[model samples]
Target: MGWLLMIALAALVLLALWKVAGFGRLGLQLAGAALLLAMAGYAWQGRPALAGRPVPPPARLELPESAFAQTREAMLGAVDQASFWLRMADSYHQRGDTYSAAAILRSGIRAHPRDPDLWVGLGNALVVHADGMMTPAAELAFNRAAAIAPEHPGPKFFYGLALAQGGRFDEAERVWLALLARAPADAEWRPMVVERVQMIEQLRAMQRARPTR
Candidate 1:
């Protein structure tokens, strides 16, 4: 019976704790008392006679590639040494391992200190790792990237993205507006920026119309 198996398992655990784990007499007594309390609680509440059902496996978490990856490759060269590191980080990011992605970017930054693309990637990884919140460290990484390449669009675009994701929509709009002002008419990524700005405006309008309790 389930109750018999439960008691046997508890006894085995207590024996291991007392012998292999070197618990003293008082510790063993306390552990035994805790086990008895747990068993008593189970006896009162548990459905021991119910048929056992198979537990379903957990669903897999599928992470997609960054939306800005293509734009980044367009702005920053795809064949450079920095790109190798970025690709490595991207692999980790796609696997839902943002911490490892950020760490890999850090190592890349150490090797290529002035690589703006690597810094941008690091900022993104940090933001994702923080559950879409724009942490101070992520902001610093974006700023460093911008400073390294004053004319590059990657840092500003991704920085605005992080800000928008963190619910700082107003700040994101301002940053994107500035980028648009300086962006060339024929720039490939300019259309994407314009679209994002329009989306932000719509979001703000919806927020204003929302009824507050």
Candidate 2:
């Protein structure tokens, strides 16, 4: 579309310049056409990533049965009822209503303060919130969750993401790289770590470009 527009506009400019028979006017007209062509070229080059993604059949995510045990033990026997809050929390999450999800998570945490799962859920909500303060909340949540389930990878990943988002790049790299080492060989998150590594490299490039004192 942009290419067509650029061509039509260039043709119109050339035609007008031809009718006027002024070399000076033609040069200016050609310059304007050149600018339009450059813009068209840029937009044409950028259109693919903007296209919507094709639907994918849900891939079966295989974690250990220990995953359920970890999550359940974190609930301290209240796992069954926790679903009530989770159902509502998920609705809020789906709508991008993180505040409500965070509130529900907080309510669940308060009701079961020792429940590691609820604490982590609340922390996850805060991390994902549009207005969330990542530094303090993610720090607290991941710390608590990790303290409770030191062997689990989920909280550690969240912690790394939180650190990255908060500009703690070195720490985030350490956490994520360690996770990549221990993660299941074919786990989806290993690819995610690759993406995060790319992000960190971009940030490092920008940092190197800055005037450092």
* True-vs-predicted CA distance for residue 117, candidate 2, Å: 4.0
Off by over 4 Å in 2: 1-87, 93-98, 110-115, 128-132, 135-137, 184-188, 206-213
After superposition on all CA atoms, what RMSD does each candidate show versus the true structure? 6.5, 17.3
Which segments of candidate 1 are over 4 A away from where they belong?
1-60, 75-79, 209-213
* Candidate with best lDDT: 1
Structural similarity to truth (TM-score) of each candidate = 0.67, 0.48
Candidate 1: residue 31 Cα off by (Å): 23
**lDDT (Cα, tens digit) per residue for candidate 2, span 65-148:** 222223433323355656677656767766656678779988887787766666666666676663434647656977898788
| lDDT (10s digit) by residue, model 1, range 68-95 | 5655776555748788888888888888
